[model samples]
Target: MFRRIKITLSLLLTLSLLLIYLPQSLPIAGAAAAGQASQIDAVLVVDVSNSMNTSDTDKIGNEAMKMFIDMLSTKGDKVGIVAYTDKVQREKALLEIQSPSDKEDLKKFIDGLDRGPYTDTAVGITEAMKVLQHGADPNHEPMIVLLADGNNDFAKNSGRTQSQSDKEMAQAVQEAKDAGIPIYTIGLNADGKLNKQALEDLANETGGKSFSTNTADDLPQILSEIFASHLKLKVVPIQSMTGNGKFQEVTINVPNASVLEANISIMSSKPVETVLVDPTGTEVAVPSDNVLLSKSKSYSLIKLLTPAEGDWKLKVKGASKDKIDINLVFNYDLELAIDPIPSKTYKTGDKIDIRASLTSNGQQLPNTELYTNMNAVLVVKDLDSSKTEEIKLTNTGDSFEGSYTIADKHEYELTVRAEEKSFYRETEPVTVSAKGTTSSSGSAGVTTPKPADVEKEDAKPFPVMLTIIWGLIIATLLGAAILIMKMIQKANKGFVGQLVIEIRDENTNEKTFPQYKKLGAFKGKFNLHQLLQLAPELKETEGFIFIPGSNDRIIIRSQNGGTLEKSGRAVDISKGLELKSGDRITVPLSQADKTIFLEYLV
Candidate 1:
């Protein structure tokens, strides 16, 4: 009985050892529980721009917030909130709880947010940093998740320009980087016109990831994946190529885990030779070596050398068979090229004839069949209307010509794309101006008026013309009455003639007289000839004349003889001279002297 009991005890001990040592095949109870221990601290910065006031933005925000809260709650971690507009209005403390709480506070904050007219992202980041600095402990990893629909337009003070705001915001980001904070940015727009580049830079600098979202509905799933599988993947070497004009052997190494299988394949713009080998140094079936591996395996070697130089892709499928997880790496080599082909520009209802010659490195390619596989798009946009038209090209060997007629005047840009194998070259831009046709009237050959002349003719002339006629009539009546009264008194008024004089003042340089035209009376319009007569001293070289009420003297010169036509217009000259009791008028002479042109009727 003692011998039998000893054998039975040894068998039980052996069974317990098998359960403890071989955990992979055994039913492990706490394997998932071990994974839950590692948690991360996440901060979400959301944009509440006026443009994001739609139901889509609200739904995405709510769903993403719910997922984040759920994940963090499960991990017993803390999550913070920052609701931003043109300014950061509401912020919540990082809530750390042992049990999941209803997201009432977060929902309330989101509901109360008022969509702002503008965005000031710099201020929002500063506010977020304050919350993060206070909430994050030294032991936990801190990450910032930024969501924005627009660029940074935060101003230091009122009246700041866009460029000034950009500079301030860039400095603020640099400050955050210095404080050891990592930022993960998400662009919610497809075109990425906003602060996308800035957000990407923030992510790269802070050792965080950047993601782009095309549709708002994809946000929840993407965020969930981010939280669930937050593993950091670092590519070793990052680049590898086959040598010796053929693909013969290739190798890849993954640290921290043994590689179970690796399958390699090559793709190029042009066909070339290829060969592949497995990890066990065994040759696999090379059914058309150009295509390479097609199965899931532990190790693979690819050998390929391409003839064309454009873009090439090498796909590497690797699996950690020991862990039952697979990983993939894609290697890309893109070549650069230059091709000269004159693209065509066309208007609607007009036909386009396109002719092109393709050459590379100063050598013309062989007589290859020209494929007219091109797509043409026409976008017409104005203040009140917009329309778009898409046209597909038909294959025409060597050369292609087509016509399109346009109905209205517009500015258009045409793009032509040519592809051969993996090589593609886009032609330079072509602009087409399409305007409605004009009909000729009579034999005048389409008389089109100059824009400037048309504008001048359109100006109103009623006010100016009436004023001139009235002033001329009044001046004529007054001059006739004064002359008749003076003649009756036998006043010795001087005859009309050119009188030249030079006058100077203490302060400024002399200026030339401007031409003024005079009509029939003092109230009549003064022409250029009258202006010369009034300042005859201007006729002499370097001589100047000063009118009574004017501030500056005017220089005058004569091109022909000093004689010039004078108007019969008259004016009172009593204020500008020290007249004698019998003097009616005084005139300035060429000798820097004053002469009486008319005697006063005493």
Candidate 2:
């Protein structure tokens, strides 16, 4: 009987999990077999920064993209162009590739494009996303294929932090992920100075892949990989289970799945911990190498290329206190791949070779046409010396090659011009810093602190109302002190009597002892806590003791030399202080204690 019950319980658990599947109650493979998916819309976001123009990344990228478009048999598929520098410029609006002729317009758009001043990648991504909404096939899922050669230089131009740039990118990626869109990023060269890791991180967070190439000639092959394998995926939506308070748990059931990609976002500002549990009931490790930490571990995005099919559970903590939860689910996504790797970085004295990678949207141009269709010019400038020179670079193949010597120990700006188009990269501008030179300034030698601030004009006077109020307060106090001293000298204060204090209930008309208090909350209690409220000076004691002087005059002095008043007038009681019968004594309380009251045996 015990064995049967255990078996029954196990069966019930499995049955409960079966309900975790999508509302359709069918597997993804089964859905795909049903033939429901349609065209996938893609946005081509190009970096029109100076670096792309100078390094020929823009030219190579254009040829590579046009070749990829030619290879794609996307009959009804739509593609849009998003070119950006400091802002987004939608060159060719979202257009469908109805026939082979539409490819030429796109090629022309890429060929005629020019470089912009700064790199606003986040702005480009955001604007590109909006472009996907117009004239888009409702059945298609949108994707952004972004290519960047350098880091976002908008920080220096806009006078904001790189963190703001990072946050903006993260937010845009999150928005894409929420809309079931994936972002595939291609980085030309992000060697810390260019922020290549940020591109990789954004890709990871969005369940997308990051590609990189050092040279411009090999960029077209990267573009080819994105178009060659157009994997069509069906969107699966499962019933969501809600959890609360720190560690919220949710399960994503990917039945008969080959690839699993997910984005987990905490609906909170505070950082949270997101852990994944496989179908085998074992917790998956947070791979430090694969994770992209944005804004200091605030975003948790994980991508699983080959996931085990079972009940994949997502566990999140940190948002429980705020009633915030994590949004985690499997989204259909893909990434671009780079080929022919190991692109080199050229220095000041090193010669850089630019070759025959130029192509319009139609065909790849040959190296011989470089002289007629394009001419390369290299301009170098030393900021410290304010010296500059322009030299004609020689074309190697479909590219140009040039070399220069570092003669000045100052920052430099290297620009490339081809066919009346000038290209400039925002990354380390002509970074040929002189050896053995040190300064208390930031990289780029732009921001430096001053030794002294410039002097300003003298401060003006206070307001008239403020000046009059302060003057009256000082004069009144001085006048009262003089009057008190004069009266003390003339009055006779030699009378004697025993000092006594009479206590009466202000509301009840009944006399009470010193320890009595109206402790309504703790009524019928004669506790020392009540006595402390009456005479706080006897803070640690339960009672007070006083002795009368031989003379009837009573003197009260403050230990801290604080001011005291009688009948709203200042008193010089510190010098031979005296009091009389029926004289009510009221002592002001310190900031930390309540006011006290006494009577001279009236």
Candidate 3:
């Protein structure tokens, strides 16, 4: 019995030691999975000409615009509106959507849109660009969506002539292209009088899409497509329903946690009601903290914020004869990255292979059904001629691969764009120089210099004296850099002013006088032993160190057994807490005994 008791105690001792020495690891999985979402700034340039009054007698365009506004997430996305005829008629500066109230206000503004006498497409485009230029976010992706009949109508005595207006329009489009802002054009061809070619030119020149429809009723669908394309998302079609005045249930998968938002749009001839059931079989209430429901005359939209990863059930109710079409657009926080190019230069006619992949939480996404429907393309641009070309890529299980042939000797910029039925991503542009047979000036033929001229250029003597002079200059600069580095190192070894400290007892409410000590007197680290000399009453403090940090700040590092606080909030001092001037820190000297109060006086 004695031997067995001793063995049991030894095992417990070993376990205690292991616990004391084990490293503490934080739970970091999925903590950085969904990073910050990129913001979007969009401008709606609408043509409210007299022709629109006839082409859209019911003002369906207004309803479409309102739907587009409702689709925007309350995630700091900005929007502007420009209604124009021969000149700017009404304008709304860029407004950020922070809540449901902001979207309602914007829709109300769209409701008051009135028709004007004539249409000058140039005026509409320019005023929209002006609104963006005045109040655009530098970090946001900016775009302009123009809705027009594409007619160039100017009343007599209007300040601008047709030729001048055309010139201004061309210049404005070029400016937008230079600023990397795409102009999406929606042409209403209800009367078959739409200037189709004009609208296409505007979109094609600025890397945007041109959409047209013959019936005004199609305006809402077109608007939804434009909104999705502009934000690199896709319009996923759900089941179409023939309502029977009873609630019908449909199941939709939320897919993955990378999705930042899921906007489900229900388009119908009349307003339909909806109810949502989450994956856990819990009924989700509309207008709650995580769900937003927007209803209009022709549509009802439900936006789910950071939806759970699983299947979701949605119930819909409408009139007996109503037709309801449902669709979903998912906004993801995943990033697509292209592998680095093997070389920075290539010969003409060489085939360059590109590979790209998707990542969330900085980890590559595995091969799954998500890549089966994805489309990848390589966009090549000539640096000198400003020409662009797209090459399609195939999905190779978990990655995308494609090859492009270099046809000229000029420098080219390359970007890989990968898109799925739900979201799209593009990489930053990379440059590569191609050298061979083609002329840089884009001429039909290449011209080669004569052998005699090449020999003459090669025969020139090397400048030894100039080389030596440059070598000495570089040496001098390197010495100066080394000297400056040493000075900076020396300056960081000490800090100004002393640390003032006080001790207080929690059980007895006893206090101690203030004690001051120069932090520079201790080299490298200030341990508890050094501090105990200044105030012997603070003997309870152990395993604490103070190090001089940059900018007159002191770093406080603590071990186990006490709590550190700043202004009544617990401070995590396991790593270090930077205490600046005028900041006060308190650490309990024991579990239920005295406390140490510290402040830096500079």
Candidate 4:
């Protein structure tokens, strides 16, 4: 019995020794076996706009590139370079650096960068996405670093406008957001002020972060920090228990955490505890007080937990100072509905019938009041005169119906604004044409035809009389056709006679034409040549002629002191003379004589 007890004690001592030593040894062994999987696939999108030529911008670019290279060197990660201005140029993969040995080549690429005339951020982002999607592993976390020194410059080119560029950039950002790709934006110089808000919006939408750098020197550190703090993990519960039950062994699988520290939180009625277990079935005690996460490597582990369940929530919060709020919900289902009918088409003066119904789980909700506001108005406009009238809507029962008068013939736009509780809904504009009637004259005149006089005595027509009546009708039709042709010819003549004149600067040769309609009048100085051009009749006179339409009528003094007098009525020639380049004319009224400067003489 003594020997047996001694043997049992020896075995127990051996087991405890194994438990303590194996736990620490197994983790090291497993870590070695898993190898280093913290490979960062990053794309650098640089803005080469002219504004980047500023001292601050250059510093930012240089620093950002340097920081990126240093981070890659430490982690042996893959990095691609995309330089963008009006267009995007991607560095060849062979030229890119994925290891420390390729740092020289990467430095060369960064140093060779030149500023472009315009900035096209959208194009840059799109190209970056293409590079990341095609070049990087889909299973890996992909990040894009976009640097810009100007507003969306892609728009100001000779071919495109600013508004168009904004739209394209917005679309590119949205696409990146949809793809679950994070974008880190660095705005340099004034570019930050111009596009900071937009960059923040993109970052918020795409689960990324944005920073502004006044100088290029700040870029490298910022980028280094960004890459050094990246993390990606896939969280899943091994077993789930609902409504008050102890969950047995909830495991979380972490895939990567190169630049981030992750904390796994298991919420239950009781505070849950976490234990790191190795493959050898030995418990590893983690430093419960504090842990330092690595910047150049990733750690993966399976978390085990046992918790009493009553609507339990498991969350993994990224541990980084600049970390954005990433809310991940599991196993969710959603239903959407619109109050009133989802769609309708109505004409002006017609009542728009709207009914409420909710579409959920393939069923229509009828009991819900779906309370909606009825103060929305539909504005109908006469397309010709642009006359518009607003019609208010009111709900009757479950349907809201309202009528508006069809004031004129037009394609009426029916817009419905409905608010159900806190949700707001708007229907797309529905186009309905207002019926229009034509008169006999066919000049866009709407008039009803009068009934024939029934009290007039009926006269019997002879065959010759009937023939004569038919001939007159044919003659009238022929005359109408001739009249139409003449009118068309006159219109063509008028159009051909109209002239456009451009006045050019004598020194700079810059030309400008006065928009008489906008200014109503012109102001400036004139010369002899301008005066002569304004009054061509002065050419007949030696050197000069009288200034027409001047309040103080001044005689045009010739070199010989001879005053040139008007030979004919100036009004006739004035009416025929079309304004052209360098013309100096004036408008004279009896009440108030106003001198007008004519930039154009035709």
Task: List runs of model 2 lying over 4 Å from the truth.
Answer: 1-38, 155-160, 190-194, 229-602
For all candidates in order, the CA lDDT equals: 0.43, 0.51, 0.79, 0.45
List runs of model 4 lying over 4 Å from the truth.
1-36, 55-57, 73-76, 89-98, 154-157, 190-193, 232-602
Candidate 3 lDDT, tens digit per residue, 338-370?
888865457778888899888765567874656
Worst 10 residues of 2 by lDDT: 420-429
How many angstroms is residue 276 displaced in model 2 relative to the true structure, after the best TM-score fit?
51
- TM-scores for all candidates: the values are 0.32, 0.33, 0.62, 0.33
Q: In model 1, how large is the Cα lDDT of residue 243?
A: 34
How much is 401 displaced in model 3, in angstroms? 5.6
RMSD of 1: 38.8
Q: Counting only residues 3 or more apart in sequence or on different chains, how many pairs clash (N, Cα, C under 3 Å) in candidate 2?
A: 13
Q: Which ten residues in a row have the lowest lDDT in candidate 3?
A: 529-538
**By lDDT, highest first, what's the ranking?**
3, 2, 4, 1
Is 1 or 2 the stronger prediction by lDDT? 2
Per-candidate Cα RMSD to the true structure, in Å, reads 38.8, 35.0, 21.1, 33.0
lDDT of 4 by residue, 350-447 (tens): 44443332232324434334433323455555566666776666655344456555545465665555433223334444555555443323435445
Of models 3 and 4, which has the larger lDDT?
3
Model 1 error, position 269 (Å) = 41
Question: In angstroms, how far off is 281's CA in candidate 3?
Answer: 2.6
